[model samples]
Target: MAGWEVRPSDPGRARRRRMLGLLLVLCLPLAFYAGGLWQQYKAPAAVVGALPVTVQDEQLLAEVEELRQRLLVLSSAEKVSQQANEQSRLTIKLLEEQIYKQQQDLASYKGVLAPASRREGLRIRTFELQATDRPDYFRYKILLSRVGKGDTPLEGQLQVAIVGKQGDQDVTHELSALTVDVPEAAPTQSLAFAFKHFQAIPEADRFAELKVPEGFIPREIRVRAEVQGEKPLVRTFKWNKEE
Candidate 1:
C-alpha cells in the first residue's frame, strides 16, 4: 500500500497571505494620488532651492529699465532746447530796438548844435594849389578856421570862385565848389578840391593862372560859406606867391 498522504493548510498562514494581497491592491491608488499632489505643490520648492535665476533673464529685465530711463532723459532735453530758442529770439529783438533808438538820438544831437542862421566865426585862413600824379589835373587845398565860439561844431558849405584879369576887364569863373564839415568850436580845418581833366592846369603848371586887369594885381581871393538856415560867412585871403 502506498507512500505519501496530503496534509491540511495552516489557517494563520493563509489568512496572512490574503490580507497582504488585499492591502497592496488598496494602497496602490492612494500612492498614485499622493505622488501627483507632491509633483504639483512641492516640486517647485526643490527646484528653486537648488538652482539660481539665469543671467540672461536678469540682463533682459535690466535692459528694459535702462530703455525707460533713456526715454525720460530725451524728453527732458527737448523741453530745454525749446526754451532756449525762445529766449534767444526775444534777446535779439530787444537789441535791434536799442540800436535804432541810439541812431535817432545821435541825429537829433547834431541838429540842435548847428542851426542855420548866425555865421559869425567862419573864415578862410590860407589857399594852396598843388599837383597830383594825374596829367591835366590839380588839387587845391584851402585852410579854414572856425570862428564860431559855440561848444558844438559848425557845418556849412563853402562857395569859391576863380577870377581872371583881362587887359581892362575882369572875367570870373567858378573853379571848384565844396562843402566844409567843420567840427563844433574847432580852430582850424582843411579842404581839398580836385579839378576835372584840364590840360591848362597840368602837373607841370601846378600854379593857377591869375590875370590882373589894368588896375588890379590879383592879390587876394574871396570865400563865402553858408550853413543851412543861417546867414553866410564871408572872408578874403591873399594867395601866397610860392604856393
Candidate 2:
C-alpha cells in the first residue's frame, strides 16, 4: 500500500498568515518610533521640574524686578513734586496776606503821625555806622521813636550831613533825601542810609565835596508835618571835623 499524503493548508489561509506577520513586523518599528518621540517630549518637563534655574534666567528676572522698582520710584517722585507745588502755593498766599496786614498797619500809623505838632516833638537817635571795604561805602543806622502824643507815626525826611576841613576849604556832605515813617504810640524803629566814598582827605589837600544835589538838599532840614494843613519843624546840626 502507498503512504497516505497529508493535504497542505488553504492557500488563502497561508497568504493571510504571511500578511499578518508582515503587518506585525511593520507596526513594531512604528510603535518604537512613536515611543521614542513621546519620551523626547516628556524629558523636557521632567528635567525642568528637577533642575535648578540658570544664572542667566535669574539675572533676567532680577532686571525685570529692578525696572519695576524704578517705575515705582518715579511715580513717587511725581506725587512728591505735586505736593510740594501745592505747599508752595499755600505759603505764597499766606505771605500775601501778611504783607497786606503790614501795609494796613503802616497806613494807620501814617494817618496818626500826619500832624505838624507830632513832627515838632519827634525823637531821633543815631544808632550804628557800618563801614565796608572794596567799595569804601558806609551805612548809617538811626532809630526814630514813634511813641508820642499821636495816633500815627511821624512821616518826614531825615537830613544828615557830615562836615570836615580838607586843606583850606570846608568840606560838607549832606544826605537829605531819606524819608522815614515812625509808628505813633509804638516802640522805636530803625532807618538806614548808605554813603559811597564820603570822606575828606586833608593829606591830599583836596576838599572832597560830597554835598547833596542843589535841588535835593534842604537848607532847613525839617519835617513838613500835616496838621490841619502842613507846617515845617526844623532842626539843625553842625558837624565837627576829625583830625
Candidate 3:
C-alpha cells in the first residue's frame, strides 16, 4: 500500500514518441522517392549524341545538341543543389527536434527520481515563482503528490502570501486579495484541491494579480498548505528581482 500505487505516466513523453514515429514513417518514403529520382538519370550525354542523324540537319543538330548539353548540365547542378539544401533543412530540423525531446526526457526523469520515497501521506514538490512579461505580474506553480495506497484523497486548503517590505519593515499580503475567490473564476487563488495521487494548480489561476504599492518591494513568498486534522505545512521562498 506504501510506495508507488501506480507508476506515473508521462503524457508528454508518449506524445513525443508518437511524433517521432510519424516522422520516421514520413522520412522513409521521402528518402526512397529521392533515391528513385537520382537513379533515373544514369546514362551519359555522349551516348545520346552518338545516335545516327539525317545528313542535311547534322551541323545544325550538333549546335543544338551542344546548347542542350550545357542547359542539361546547368539544370542538373541546380537540381542537386536544391535537393542538398532540402536535405540539409530536414537534417537540421530533425536534430533540433531530437535535442528538444531529450531535454524534456531529462526534466521528466529528474522529476520522478529527485525526490526520495516518503512512504505515506502527502508532500509538496517543486515550487517556482516566475516573473511574467506583463508589468507588476508574476506566476507561481506548485506540484503536490501523495505516497502510499493513494486510495484516500489528500484534502487541503492552499494559502499563499507575499511578504514584502512596505518601507523599512516587512509586510505580508494574502494572495486572494489580488484574484477572484470562486469556483467559476480564479480557483487557485484560495481553493482546496483534492487528489489521490497528484495535482497541478491550474495555469490560468496560478498567477497572483498583485496590486503592490509603488514603493513596497516584494521580498518573500510564503505558502501554507493545511491538511485536515494535520498541522499546516509551510514553505517560505525568498524573492528577488535578479532571479
Candidate 4:
C-alpha cells in the first residue's frame, strides 16, 4: 500500500490543482476591491433605503456630489444657448417683416409720384381706405399730386372728412373725429405736404387708424386742400364699395 501511494502522479490532476491555486491568488485582490466598494458606496440591504454609512462612504458621497454639480453646470449652459438661439430667430423674423413692408410702401409711393400722374393742377391721385383685421378699425392712404407744373413744389395743408350714416340721420366726421367710435368728437387733423411733383401723406399725418361706428356705412370721403396762393381744392370721392 505504501508503494502504491508513491505511484506516478496524474499529469492532468496536477495541472488542475496548480491552475486553481493561481486563480485564487488572482481573485483575492478583486474580491477585496469589490468588498471595499460595497462597504463604502452600496447599501448592505441592496434596497433603496437609508444606508449605514462610514467615513469612507462620505468621501464617495462627496465624489457623487461633485459629479452632480458638474452635470448641472453643463446642462445649464446647454439650456441658455438653446434659449439664446430661439430669441435670435424671433428677432430676425420681425426684421424681415419690417423690411418687406417698407419695400411695399416705397413702390406704392413711386407709382403715385411718376411723371404721368400729373393730369391736372393739384389733384387727388388715389384715396384708398382699407379695413384691418380688428373690428371697427380702418387705415387710409391718400395721394395728392400736381401736374403740368415744371419743377415748382406744391405747398399746402390737406384735410380728410368722412361722410357716413351714424344712425337714422346722415353724419360727417373728420379724420380726428373718427379716432373714436362716438359721433360727437373734437378734431385735431392736418395733413400738410410740400413736394415738387407729388405728395403722399405720411403715417403721422394720415388717418392711420379709424374707429367706425357700429352698423355705419361709409358713403363718400372729401379731401380738401388749400394751396399757398390759391383757394381750397375740394375733391369728393365715392367710397370703393367692392373693396
Best-fitting candidate, scored by lDDT: 4
Candidate 3 local accuracy as lDDT?
A: 0.66
RMSD of each: 21.7, 16.0, 41.2, 16.4
TM-score of 1: 0.36
Over 4 Å off in model 1, which ranges?
A: 1-9, 33-42, 45-59, 118-243
Worst 10 residues of 1 by lDDT: 193-202
Candidate 1, residue 87: Cα displacement in angstroms equals 1.5
Number of the predicted model whose TM-score against the real structure is largest? 4
lDDT of 4 by residue, 1-243 (tens): 465555776999999999999999999999999999988776656544544456569989999999999999999999999999889976865565455445545654564455765455676666766655577787666766655645777788888888989668898877767764433534655767887665655442344567777788778888899888887888888876412
How are the candidates ranked when ordered by lDDT, highest leading?
4, 3, 1, 2
Q: Each candidate: how many clashes?
A: 10, 5, 0, 0
Candidate 4 residue pairs in backbone clash: none
Tell me how far the alpha carbon of residue 220 in candidate 4 is from the true structure, in angstroms, after superposition: 1.4
TM-score ranking of the models: 4, 3, 1, 2
Stretches of candidate 2 off by over 4 Å are 1-59, 78-104, 107-116, 119-243
What digit string (tens of lDDT, one per residue) describes model 3 on residues 136-195? 765555566565554778898988777788889878777666443334455345657797
Error of 1 at 59 (Å): 4.5
Per-model TM values vs. the true structure: 0.36, 0.29, 0.45, 0.47
| TM-score: model 2 vs. ground truth | 0.29
**Lowest lDDT block of 10, candidate 3:** 202-211
